[model samples]
Target chain A: MDSYGLLIDFSACIGCKACMKACKEANNLPGDPGDHLSYSDYTVVKQQGDVFYRQMCMHCLTPTCVSVCPVGAMAKSPEGAITYDGSKCFGCRYCMVACPFSIPKYEWNKAVPVVRKCILCYSRIKEGKEPACAWVCPMGATRFGKRDRLLEIAHTRIARWPDRYIDHVFGEQEVGGTSVLMISPIAFSDIGMRNTLPNEPLPNLTWTILRKIPNIVITGGIVVGGVWWVINRRMELEKENSNGKEGKVEK
Target chain B: MGRKGKLKNKLFLFLPISLMALLGLFLTFKRFYYGLGSVTNLSDAFPWGLWVGFDVVCGVALAAGGFILTAIVYLFNAERYKPVLRPAILTAFLGYILVAVGLLFDLGKPWNIWHPMVMYNPHSVMFEVAWCVILYLSVLALEFGSIVAEALKWKKVVNIFHAVAVPLVLTGVLLSTLHQSSLGSLFLIVPQKLHPLWYSSLLPLHFFLSAVAVGFATVILESYTSSKFLKRGLELDLLVDLGRFLWFALVVHLTVRWQDLFVSGALANYRPGSLEAIAFNLEMALLIGAVVLLTIRRTHRSKLGLFFAAMFALFGVIVNRLNVSIVGMLSDTQSGYFPAFSEIIITAFLAMMGFVAFFTCVHFLPIFPQEDHNAKAELKVQLSA
Candidate 1:
């Protein structure tokens, strides 16, 4: 299966938010929610000094929202698109807590605002088109393709001009390899990539603990149940014995 | 059977009902007319508030009394504590239901809450936790239902229930253990986001221990509160037995708390002026006070002192929950988030529900044993001697 990935080279990137504008247009998003969290602005471009950073869904190998969602409202396709379903969302906001990137935003102002986030424009891709953001990035900073080819592009650049790029590819191992990759002159962690996070998927951390809950329930239930049965059985027997003694006294 | 009556016929039910009715009306109006934005102090920085933290987490923790006390008396066969079983079960029943109400209000799309069950997010911890809570609530309802049936003279039904109660009690305890710890596990994912002092991979263990300690404390308060209102004498023998359990659990909890602190290797966070330090000390002080009070045979035996200790434990539990949910939110602060007056009303209303249910059950119901007969029998024996 094809795993769609984006490699952003901050060193080559100029701080033009044309990609963000194109995403807004392609998604047919209505602008400026009375609340910024709703109404479908799928992508944003953030700048720190000379560097321009593009922000959107990482299409994480293990999306926290997927793990924490009680319903299957949030899903990650085998092809690696992180997807959402408004109809199924209970609007628990647990996904918001679980997401490391903090990308999912809620429409709290509405009677019911399901969580909103980037979806890689899978529909557009299925129709033989690149994501709107990549198509509009004239500088070629954000390019979408198979991850192996993207890694080749990243390594070639580093070898060609060693000092121009850091020795790291940001998404290669971050949160179990986000589909969106980055090569930057500055440290990725400084730009909020969370370098200290584990190389494994984020879900692995919580799942280890969660998986044991059922076991605890089963074992603890037996112990408690066993005790209750023994005690109650003894109580019933004693009452029965007492009744027999009263019958003898009557005779 | 003749003495038994409906909850509405009971004395002292007036105030809690009136308070609840008014608050319910306000909350309903606010929810429909204005929406969640008009209510809670929730923001991108904090998506949880009193509804989630207090009503659900702290409320459920306090409600642990049902399983905690039952495990002691039924599972462990501490018959000395049997007098408290009925009241503790009553509190647990109300506490879990109120938690459900709080959760319904907290949901952003409450209308779709059934999505979890139907949609089946197998990977989600929430999916697991939600199922567990629902099951546990049913178990609690059944546990308490037996006592109610017994009171209502439905002995045939009660007999059937009595047969299955041990199994139900086991299920309830197991369910309680899972969800109680899962509440802490909810925060474990936000390790970087939460203040280091509050977040731990061992959050499940921490949550379980704290709840056990709180469970014992709440029973203490409920006993005193019931005795005063129902005009029954305080059970000193039971209190002493309960005091021993409280001391043991508190010591284990303290040891774990310190163990967590030591393993973190963040000793500097424990300094006098750090926000974490103050909260740490305050919670510890309250918990330590509970422990110390239990050690004193005279104070542990005193109804007034015992009640205060229980109150202190409740305070400690509340402080810890708030620290995790609000103060420990790991994200940078966002602009302007304050809970609307409507949210406050809703919180108050839940408390009112708890009081109303508690008061109603105690009066005109066999929630408290017939202490008068027992006391008279004891007096007659002493006179004969």
Candidate 2:
């Protein structure tokens, strides 16, 4: 299915944070001056040395949070949003460990808490509108379009500004390709983003080990069962032979 | 056997248990009423704290004794080990119950803990863990139930349980192995998050191997404790036999771990003076010490030496689990986590409750085979003579 994606050109962002304010208002979240994403905040804009970086969910193609959730509470939607279902979340927080981006935040203050993260404004996409963050970006730093078209846009910008931009698109291949792409002038790591994530998905690492369990169990069972049978049969035979000897002695 | 005599005998244990239980109850109520932020030091950067790291993870690791003993006694037909099987199963059953209770307290919506049973995410390691723990707990109950039947003179019920004992024990073993490894699998996604020393592709194998060693060590510790307090003499031969197995498991585990480190080029992680390095060294030392002591005939022959070795091994497992769950995950920037007063009190209560349950089972159930008592009495007379 055709999927949508977002591209954030850090060089173009003015650090204004209008996107953050618009997102809070659009999602009906509490207004706060804080620059970190929390349960009450879906997205934020942080400034590091005159560059503004939008911090939110990457909405990964092979979403680790979705795979690690015991109840399928976190999900990757067909519309390219990484959605969350509070009704299915029982607060195990395995998703917290599994997310490569460390995106999912818990409602820790509430007695009944749920995981919270960016949904890429799936509701708006369903209504044929842009995400609030993308719509509010005045410099066109945050652009939303089809996933293929976004990749083209991100690459074209980087190729056109070789001296101005880094020769990389941060999320294009990070942790098996995220829907949130970025083009930055400085190194991704310098701006506090994890740049060393493996190109393959994180979930595959666990699966590689888990896949052997069924084989081990079956083989282990057979081996153990065989040993038990042999030992019991030998003991029974020894008992029978001793009974025969006693009968002969009595005779 | 007198009422006043019995009360006095257990007075020491009951005082601490009652106090801790009361405190734990009060704090637990506050936690549920006021929410996690009012109780724990957890935040977005530190989502998990003492309850998950210590109470649940360490609890499960320590409870591996039941599966190990059950497999040896039933599947391998080592009837000599059968005496300790019931006690092991009882400990495991209590351990799992405590783990479940710990999860309830740690979870934000404690009431929805059962959602995994119906929701069914096969890809999730946690889903496997949830199912395995629930299934294995049932297996332990049934296995321990046979002991209850025998103790209460329900011969027919005992016979029925015995008929299905082999399969029941095997299922327990399978389930135990799955969850124990899955606990390690839980860390697999956090390669960047977890320190390289502890994180490896062989994490699941490391968890399983260490658990096997811990299982044998816990059995030795339990036997030692029972012998001291319950006035029963040590089962010298059985303890030594288990010690040999413990040694073997340690050797295999250490070998594989070092090999994994070498292959992964993570040997550089052993920079001396780092907290992770120190913890890693201490854990390795304990494992090596236990292995050395267990290999020596003199050490295994003496109950005191065996007890120390077992204690060391058990501590090693504890240290390793804590390092993986809490210490290794700590990045320099994030605020460190320390167990709140409520967390510590609840953990102490759970441990106390395990001891209480063990004592109750020993008093009421046929935990040890009858012949061991006769043998012990004979040995005691010979020693006195």
Candidate 3:
């Protein structure tokens, strides 16, 4: 099966947001309304001191949103992009809950709102093209390729510049891995990556409980419901035989 | 005078609902014709409005009486409680219908609702909730079918219904368990978005426990209303029994709830506008207060105390559902979504419909058992004691 991923190398990079500009134009997205509460930049450059952070959907291997949605609205394509179908969306905002990265933004300002996020340009990929963000990154900072090759490349860069690179690949272990990998100079946690997470995928935790719900409910219902039946039957037998002779109802 | 008294009682039912029903009718038109956006405060940020918070999640939980009642009468074999069975079933049926109606208003594309209904999406938690609701509604209807059949003098049909009642009740209980808990599980995906205090693996469990408590509380509330309006004997035994159940549910709910808080270490963040914390606290306090009052032997014995405790528990559970769905959920921008006046009125209308439907059933059918008359005799005997 064909697999794909995006790799962003911060150390080798410039801070120009050509990727964001290309993304907006390529996707026919409207201009930003100029607010933090608003998101026109599918990909943006965030600078903490001289360090520039380009952030968008990490396109996790195991997405939390996919597991939690009741209607299967947000989904992970086999090709590795975290794609969404607004037509299937229920407006529950549960997707907002599942995404630890807080990447999925709901169109809250609009009355008929749906969630919006980067798909790594699934449309372009379907047309056998790279995501506009990677294609337009002039610094050669963002590279799109197979997951295996990206990992090899990321590791080679780190080994080549031990003093310049943080040992950790941002998406390698976070939330059970991601399609998008990042190489940074500082600690990954410095850019707000959640450091404290179990090695297993988050869906594992919820999935374990979710899988057992039907069984537990069936068994719990039978046991609890059985007791109710026996008690009710005995009461019925008594009620019918006594024929209102009793003073207080024996509930 | 006797006929006039009957008419006066009928008037009592209509008095509470007429305006609300009319408004509900109007909104029912508006929601379908105009779309949810026209009349609601729902934004993309807050897609679910009062209808979802108040109706589907909390509304159905409030109506959990059907599951509990079925569990009590057909499963556990609680006999003396039979007097209120019909009323409880009727209350549940109407509660579910109201939830269904409420959902019709909340969906963004109500017209395309049938897509999910027809096309099976096993992965969607919503699909599970929807099927459970649909199947359970029918189960409830079948479980309560005997009552209507009994009233209609369909002796053969009533006998057939009685034979199936146990299984139907069991089905209803099972279906209810799926959806009632699934309601909370719906948020399991929103782990990052929900306020940490309310988010836990045990959400479904919390929902299940609260639904059980609320189910009994709803019946108690209805029973109190029944006693006053029907001039029937208030069944204090059921209240005492329900109180016992509520005490157990409260202890478990409190333990699990606080355990979640304690482990989450989220208790430190408690303050106003921390919707989940406030909601969690309110749920705990309301149930605890109800347990305290009703657990006292004398308190359950009194008509007024029992009535109030039941009402409080009902309100508490309702508030808890609303909080988990709306208030407790967190986003970076804490935009408070107040439901439009029209939204609130539509909710009121549905509630009025519930009461009116319940009253209509009780009046026409032999829903309140003749045994309720014995309460007066029991009271006289107590007086002598």
Q: Which candidate has the highest lDDT of all?
A: 2
lDDT of 3 by residue, A1-251 (tens): 25789999998677787887788888676785222323355677777667887888988898887876666777789789988888877655656655777667765434455678888899889888999989998887899999878988999999999898988888877788889999999877787666765557777766666678668877877787667656666766787677956464433
1 or 3: which has the higher DockQ? 1
Q: Each candidate's lDDT (Cα)?
A: 0.76, 0.83, 0.74
Off by over 4 Å in 1: A32-39, A229-251, B1-24, B330-341, B371-385
What's the C-alpha lDDT at position A225 in model 2?
Answer: 77
Per-model DockQ against the true two-chain complex? 0.50, 0.55, 0.27
Supply candidate 3's per-residue lDDT for B89.
Answer: 85
Candidate rank order under DockQ: 2, 1, 3
Question: Best to worst by TM-score, what's the order?
Answer: 2, 1, 3
* Candidate 3 local lDDT, B1-385, one digit each (tens): 9999989987885665676677778877776566666677765456666888888898889879878876776576665566567778888888888888777667655545555566555655676777887888888777667677666667677667765666777778888888888888777755555667677778888898888878877777767766776676446766767767766776677678778879888777677665555677787678778878877878867777777777777787787887778777534326577888888888887777777677678778766666454653343223211
Output candidate 3 Cα RMSD: 6.1
Q: How does model 2 score by TM-score?
A: 0.94
Candidate numbers sorted by lDDT from highest down: 2, 1, 3
Q: Regarding DockQ, does 1 or 2 come out ahead? A: 2
Please report how far candidate 3 places residue A141 from its true position, in Å.
Answer: 3.1
